[model samples]
Every structure is written in C-alpha cells, then in structure tokens.
Target: MEFSRRAFLAGTSALAAPLLLAKCGFVGGGGGSSSDDADTLTFTTWGTDAELAGFRAAIAAFGEANPGQTVELNAVPYEQMFTNIDAQLQAGNPPDLFRVPYYTFGAYAGQGQLLDLGPYLSADTQDRFTPAAWAAVQNEGSPFGLPHHTDTSAVLYNRDLLTSAGITTVPETAEEAWTWEELTGVAQQLRSALPADRYPFAYNWQGNGVTRWLSLLFQADGAFLDTDQRTPLIDSDAGRAAVEFSSSFFSNGFVPANNTTTSASYASEAWFGGTAAMVWSGAFQIPDAETTADFEWGATFAPRNVRGGSDFGGNALVATAQTAKPELAAAFLEFVTERDLMADFCRSASLLPTRADLQGDALTFDVRPELAPVFAGQAATVEPEDAAQVASPFMSGIIPVLQDQLDQAFLGSQDAAAAVTAMAAGIADATR
Candidate 1:
C-alpha cells in the first residue's frame, strides 16, 4: 500500500542517464526552471485514425498556444501497449499523461501510481459530467482521472430484417421489452437467413465475455462480486441465469455455434450478409455498422436485465508520475476537458461527450443520428452498474479464466455455476 517513492526513484537517474541528451524530443521539453516544472510532458494513446488526428491537432494547438511547453506523443499500438508500458514505467520514467481505458482504471488509480487531480477539477469546472461516470472513474477521494468520453453497450439490430420479420423498431420502452426467452425466440425465427457455419450473434471477447454477460446480472439485480469486492458471485442463481441467458442464445440456434471462430469480423459479416439480426457493441462499433449493413441498421439499449442496469464505459485521462510538469499536465487536462474541446474530440472519435447537456445538442445528434436512442437511454438511467476493478496484473491473469472458464459455459462446454465458482477463488488469490 505504500507509495514507495524511494523504490520508484532509486534507479531512475542511472537508467535515465543516456537519454538525458535527447530526452527533450522523447519526453517533451519544458520542465520549467523550477524542480517541478518540466520542459516537456509526454502522452500516449491508441485508437481510430480520426480520433488520433484530432488528438494530434489538439496537442499542436496546446503547444502553439503555450510557446514554452511541448507535448510529445506516442500512439502505442493496442496489441503492444501492455509490453511497452510495462517496460517504460518500470524504468526511470513513463508517460507524463496518458489514456486509461475503464478496464484498467480501478487497478492503476487504486495503486497510487497516478497523480490525483480532484482539487483541480472541483472549481466551478466540474459540473458537466454524469455523476455516476465521475464515481466510476475516481478512486478514494483523489480523482485520478476524468472521463474523456463514454458509450454504453447496445444491440445493433438490422431494421430491414426486423421489419421483414414483422417486428417494428427496438421496443420503445424497456417494460414492453423482449425478455431473455423472447429475445432468443426471435433469433430462432430469424435464423432462416443464416447459412452454414454461422448463427445469430457475433461475440467479440472482453473479460472473457463475462462483463458483457454482467449486464444481464445487473438487470437481474446480481453483482459481479460481493460488495467487499473479494469474491465473484457469478456462480449464484442470478449468475447462473446470466450464464443460462447467454447459453440459450448459442444453443437455441440464435447465435452461431461459436466453438471455432474463424474470424473476428462477426459484426461486419453477420449483419452485412444478413446472417444475424443483431450483435452487442458500443458506439465505436458504429462506423463499421455504417459501412457494412446492406439494409437499414440501428442500435438500441442493452435489454433490461431483471435488475435494471446497462453496461457503461468512458475513456479517462490520467497524469502519470513520469511527468516533471504536473502543473502543466493538470492545466492541459483542464483545457482538453473543457466542454468545447470535449465536444470536438467526441465528434471525431465517434463517441458521446461526458457532458450531459451535449447528449441533446444538435451537433452530436447530427454526426451520429442513429445514436439518439443511445443518448436517450443513457440519460434516462441515473446510474450505470458498478464496474469490477482488478489490479493491473490481475487483468491479464484473470482474462484467460474468463475466456476458458466463463466462456466455456456460454459456449456450452462447461456448467456456468461450476465455471464461475472456480474463477472466484482465483480472483481472491490474485487480488491478495
């Protein structure tokens, strides 16, 4: 639990010795004359071409507006981020500023590796975001990060297929909703369009597919782990139902027999080819939908699980100890997070801004009009289900358990109750 400043600083100078001469180009160069002021601050991120372009333009704008300061950026590839970041941080320094996906927020912020900026945001500036998102991103009292943008999971459904099937738009209200059985039944009815080797839904894996399933649990009033966060409750009745819920899709011919997936482009192929009626994904998945669906396509909120919550996410900005200019880092955060900048970044990034009012703004709706349902759904709900935070190391270690153990249930190979119970023990040990 200790910050261990000495352990962090011990080899920094020696490891940094060779890089001192060229550190300006690599680390950003303006650590001011003062000890805490650095000449440069580094940043890192990985993403869409449009989003990256916007980020670079924003950085350039920031540097130009402040002649003495510079922002050196490294857009780390998604596949290589873990490897590169591990080596960089363990070394003398890492990035001054960086993006932390929600999946990793709990781990980093809980560990004290990130600098706190809660006080900085408290000034009349903090009123814009959804409070649930704020709690979701903050750790303890210190705000380790501020959300950059957010998008929740939804069912991207094919309208022509639904209309052809005699169904209208996605159910307007959650209560008029298709319960799990009805959802699968509809998939069975639509399965006629599927050819050999494909079924109804395409699953892109995350948290071994458990997090996605957790939305069901949320609707059912079940939690991923107990309140203490020590054990995963995925083996319980509701947990089993969540598992049973997904299993029904695969078994009932509603979803493809996913044991041997040949391609990750399930979303593109299934929907485009008219092989599947819907797949679950976020707004970032919209651009692909735009290009791929041959018929009218639309997205609707994740069906309400019995308990009534949906999956939610937001990109958070963090300041790492690697920056010598913490003050500048904080200022830049303020600048980018300013409502105007956030709106611009969200537009290009194919995301919703963290600001509540912007959700209804004309410009946002204009860019991704299909997302009106999404905006409305999120605004209607005051709280997103709480997220499960694992330590950084625990993330890598537990993911396989999700895929191998938890997914086995969804794929029909293992009992959901048994598989989920096994993972709970592993989570406890690894977390300790």
Candidate 2:
C-alpha cells in the first residue's frame, strides 16, 4: 500500500503517446446518440457469463435506487471490445461507460477522452481503494477511472501430473514460494519424468499479455521506466538477470516453444489440453478450470526471484467524456464500487476486489475458496510502484516493444544482453 504523491509525468508529452490519437483520429464529439433519453446510459464491456451477470445485477440495483436511471449492457467478445470502442470514440459517440484493462486505461485517459471523476466523486473517495488500485486509475495526479476489481497471476498445476513427476510438496504460502533456482529444478525434474511431447509448464504471455513478463524484472528489482515514468531503466544488471532467467524457460525446455509472447495458444489452453503440467494464469481462470479439468488441479504461488511479484490482471470502469449524462455515469461507477456491490461482483466472477476493506477473511470466493489465500497472498506482492509503472499512459506504446523484443530473446534470435539493449531503446522511443 506504499503510495506516491508525486505526479507520474513532468510534461504533457509524456502523459500519453500521441500515436494513439493519430491512429484513431479521436478528436472528441462528432454527432450520434445511443438514446434520446438522458437517463439511459449505454455501457460497453467484454466479460464472462458470470461477470456479465454481476454487472446486470448491479445495474438492476442502481435502477431500483435511482428511479429514472437505466444502464443498457452491450457485451462483446474480448478481441472485439477495444476495436469497437475505438471506432465509437473516433466517431465521437462512445458509450457513456466502458470496461478497460488497467494497462490500456492510460491511453484513453491521456488523450483526454475520459471524464475526470474528481469533479463528480467525493473528496475522500480515494481512501476507499487500495493504494495500488488507486495508482492504476490516476493520470497527472487525478482520477480518470474507478478500480472496480483486480486479479493477479499465479501457478496453476495439475496435482496428478505433479505427483507423477515425483513432486509432492508445493508452496502453500507466498513466503514459501519457490525461488527461481528451485522452480528450475522442479521443471527439470518434470522434463525428465514426462514424455518428450509433453512440457513442464506454459506462460501466459500471448498477444497483449506480454506485459506480464515484467514480474521477473520487478522481482529482480528492475524498473521498466524510472520514477519519472519517462526514462528507460531496463538496461541494468537486474535487467540482464531477468532477461537471461526468463529466456531459460525456453532453452531448458521448461515451457513449450510456442509459449512465446506472440503464440496463438494461451497458457490455460495448453494446461487444459494436457500439454503442460503447470500454467501461470490469473485467478479469473478458476471457475473455468474447476469445471473443465478432469484431473484434480491446484494453484501455487508464482516463483520468486529476489522477491515475489505478479501481474496486475484486471480491468477498470471509466466513463467517456462524450457522455451526455456525466453525473449519472459517475454515480453508477461509485455505486458499483461500494463495499457490498464490489464484494458480490468479485465473489461471482472469481476476481479480487480493489477496495482495501474487502481484502480479508470476510470476503470469501464462491468458487475454489480454498485456493483463494494463495492468490490473495500473491496479489499482495504487487507494490504500489509496480502498479503505477504498469498503469503508465505509455503502456499501449510499450506493449508492442515488449512483445517483439521478448519474442526474439525467447526464440534465441537475440541474446539476453542484446534483447535488453533493444528493449531499453524501444522503451525510450515509446515514452518519447
């Protein structure tokens, strides 16, 4: 919960990359309207069945509390949500409210495409959220969105597979989680025991998820960008160690070769298909895994380097600046984040809550409640500084750099040192 009061950027240029506006031509208000009634607000999002149900329930409750308000839910596939939002934003008719991942929130907020909640929300509202969650929604020291809920990655393993590989004991607590060397040994043991076609594990770094790889860098005490959020800091000794250590997962045959950043297969898919003994995945996968897997599976902490770290894997709810009813939209956001409502959504969706008050034994996960402690413990390792860096407005620009550079390193097209150099250079270009 270590929070920083200093602004993330020193100038407007670093606040958000100009490339987004150029690519999308989001110049604000154009013409169309979703509805004639100012009381009805259109909400766009991509979510699982449970997640959508939670939203519908919250919207129903909001409608009951406020007589004239209505929230129409427009749910789409995850792949198409952003594309549709961008088109709507460019046409100046975006939904009043939309769901956005924390990493992608900065792009919208930076371009001034989002409504600032400071004017609509209470002064003490910031105190309601965890420091790391609040940090993710801030830009230029102001709140642009609300941290609805959060999730983090952990190691999900097939119990029968691990037992077959001569592995019995697993880290039950975050503090007892395996170190990098210990994990390597476990992978080596699995590799020796399993068939050649089968692999030890699969990493969830496909597509835009390349940002999750930063857990290793942060664990090694390296920062992608310095405290200013502009300078590149990924060319140091810690950077090299992270690069070399992660690349070893590929070289040592610990994870599948197709587990590179740009691979078509996801880590969970690999685990489901019995191609991997373990998979590094987020807590959101629990409900599906619990129902889908034939074998008994369990989750453990992600391996630690010098310290434990994990990806901040959840989305935020933001109201568009183009909304006709800003006050009503802000009210909905606040209502959804209330203690009881947030806890219900998290319980239903198997996600972690961002509210500081909900992080306790009082809020039990409905699905796989026994594994909740491991994920909660792993999520606690994400310091406020780590969340702040990931939430930088430049992440949209930096994602491609991480995707391309890390893929090369994993493919052995570039050495660790060269990859670190290219990454630093790419990050420099991205922030500028």
Candidate 3:
C-alpha cells in the first residue's frame, strides 16, 4: 500500500502481479529450526524510497528500545516481493517478518503459512487498531498479522476545470459528500464544458484495482458475499444499482473511453496529464500530483449512495510460521504498530495510519497536510464488515473474476445484471 508517486502511477496501468497460490505447486513445509540467537531477526518488504527510510528509522528505534535485538531489512520491488516470499516459504527459510496486503494475508494465513500472533501479542493489542484494521489481519478469529497502515480513495480534482464548468462548491466533509445523483449531475456539467479529448472524471479501477469498484457496491449497501463469506450476494438490488451507476461512466462518456478496468492507461495518468477534470484516487498519489501537476488541484470526498464508503487500501506486517524467532518477530510487529512509530511512518510515506489513535484529524502528513483530513474522512467511511469481506483468503482468485467481468461490463460486452450474475458464479466457485 506504500507507493511513491512514480511507482503508484505506473502500477495503476500494469496488471497486478499474479499471486503465487498453492495451486502453483508450492507444497507446505515447516520453518527454520529455533535459532540460538533469538534477538537477531530478518524482515522483508517492498516500498518506495520514503517508505523504506521510514521503516529503517522504525527498526533503528526498535533496536534502541530493546538492546541486542537486530532486524536485518530486505527491500524488494513490489511485483517480485510475494513470489520471492513464496519461494522462501516453500523452502522453509522465509524471513522472520514480511509486509503483505490485507487481501493477500488471508492466502498465507489460511494455508497455515503465517504465525498466529494471538498467543504472543497482548489481548489489549486489539484495541490499538481500528475495528476494520483489526479485522483485516484476522483469520478465523485469531490475529494472523497486524495492519501497519491503511489508505483510502478520495476525489482529486483539477481546480480550474471545475471553475470552468461552473462548479464552485465542493463537499468539505465526508458527511457532505456528493451523492451518486449529484456526482452524475456534476459529471454531466463537466462533460458539456469539456472538449472532445477531455473527460469529466476517471475511476481508479484499472488492473487488479478492480477491487476498488467494491466501494461503490458498499456505498449502495450491498455485499459481494453474504456474512458466511461463502455465498455471493452480488446479484441483488444494491449490486445492480452500483454497477449501473459505474457503467454510466463509460456509456454516458463521463470518463475517457480508454479508462476501463482493463485499460493500459489509468486514472492517474488522465488526471495529471490534464485529460480529465477529476480522478478518484488515494493519498499515495498526493506527493506525485503535488510536484508534477501544472494546474491547481485539491481533494474532496468520494461520491456516496445509500451510504458513504471507500476502499480499504493498505498493507499489513506479518510474521511467517517458518520464522526461527516467533517471540521476537511478534515483538517487532507490536513495535511497528505503536502510535508514534505508525504516525511517523504514515506522515513520511504519504499514506494513512491504521492505529485507532492516529486516524481522522489525529495525525497530520508531512506532504499536503491540509489534504490529510480528506483521506482520513474517506478512511472513516470504511465499514469493518466491508474490510472483512475484502480481506478474504479467496480474494486472489476473486480479483481476476472482477477484472474480467467488470471489464466486460465497462466495455459494453455485458450489461450490469449480466456482469453481476457472472461475478456471483465466479465468486461462489472461488470461495468453494
């Protein structure tokens, strides 16, 4: 979930790296034997320069706090990170700890490849994180990992474009966020004012980001799966409404024709390149847009429907079942999620914090401090139930289903109902 400006924009256009699941023939194996020097541990993660530096600072602080404890850090590219971890895990020699997205954490935990931290972490540790964040790292009621940080999508707009379109007033708070009908009307106005080559807005659903579309479904008070996480609930009224609304972005020419979920050009490119007036994006893009954008820009809350909602976008820090130092690994996990450490990391990296104490107006960013509250507002809208569904072990399989079906819907190859039906069937199979 930590991305520098350049990496974040590039990632939006590329297909997400394929998850290395058990189906890929990675057989189970035990971790390294207990080490005599338990104080020394190895950790791995992928991050931008700023994020890596923040992590290094945190590790140094941990070393200071606990004498003789050392954490060797291994930095890798995001695309190759999981594949490497899977290889090491299969070899029974994985790092003591590694960073994982909430969606991917389930696959490892479900397979018993991750340590169950419930035994090591204090019971009060649960209260440190937001309910949604705590739920993201849990599997079957046990804490398999800890959500280190989180990010959420908001509306990043070009100031001049809105003024040219005669739209001056914008939502200042999440409670005042634009409704679906209001957003559609805004898009309509922007569309009339924009040139043939430009668009009113673009959605950040390209590639594996297809998961982001769930925010709209959630806003409509719809669940992709029932409470059991085994049944599809995406063929109902909420599903249809969410799909129809998003599909209108394409059919009604509100967004660029090439901005479909499968497109090579992503929403960030359109917004920054001046082809669109506004872009649905996350705070991770703030730094990049702040430096490179030629026009005036700012952020606002994402559109709401029956309720407000946003994508729970971020990664968690987890210990491997194969670590030789379980207690030390758990300690490191606890240290990183501490209020001060998490806040510092989030501020430096242009990401959101997961700690309950640091959310909303509690922590300010080093970059674009004023815009921090907008993303905080978006994060506040993420329901714990929505987070739980997104953090499912089946997400690796479900992502492709969403990409294909949603792409078909946006491309006019399928209608909203048809897409919803296809997604339901695919999800049922994936969960099965």
Which candidate number would show the highest lDDT if scored against the true structure? 3
lDDT per residue for candidate 3 within 1-432, as digits (tens), equals 111323322322222122222111112223463234556778899998889999999999988887777788999999999999999888877888899988788889888999888777755677788978877877766788989999889999999999999999899999999999999999999999999899999999988788899999999988886544447888888888998899899999999998888888888999999999999998988889889999999999999999999999899999988777666777788888889989989998889998889977797888899999999999999987787777778888889999888878988999999999999999999999
- The true-versus-predicted C-alpha distance at residue 325 of model 1, in Å, is 1.6
TM-score, structure 2 vs. true: 0.92
Q: In model 2, how large is the Cα lDDT of residue 117?
A: 75
RMSD in Å for model 3: 8.9
User: How much lDDT does candidate 2 score?
Assistant: 0.84
| 44: Cα error in model 3, Å | 0.7
Which runs in model 2 stand beyond 4 Å of their true positions? Answer: 1-34
| TM per candidate | 0.81, 0.92, 0.91
Q: Where's the lowest-lDDT run of ten residues in candidate 1?
A: 11-20
Backbone clashes in model 2: 0
Residue lDDT tens for model 1, 1-432: 212223322311121111112112223335422234465667888878877887887787777767767777789787787577657667746678888776677666666667676544435444566655554565543467777777666677878767766667566554555667667667776676555565556544444333455567666666555433334555567767776776676677776564222324444456566666777776776776676667788776566656455655657888875556666677677667767777777776677677656665433643456575564464344352354332132454555555566556766678777766776666666557
Superposed on all Cα atoms, model 2 deviates from the true structure by an RMSD in Å of: 6.1
The C-alpha lDDT values of all candidates are 0.60, 0.84, 0.84
lDDT per residue as tens, model 2, 265-300: 888888999999999988899999989999999999
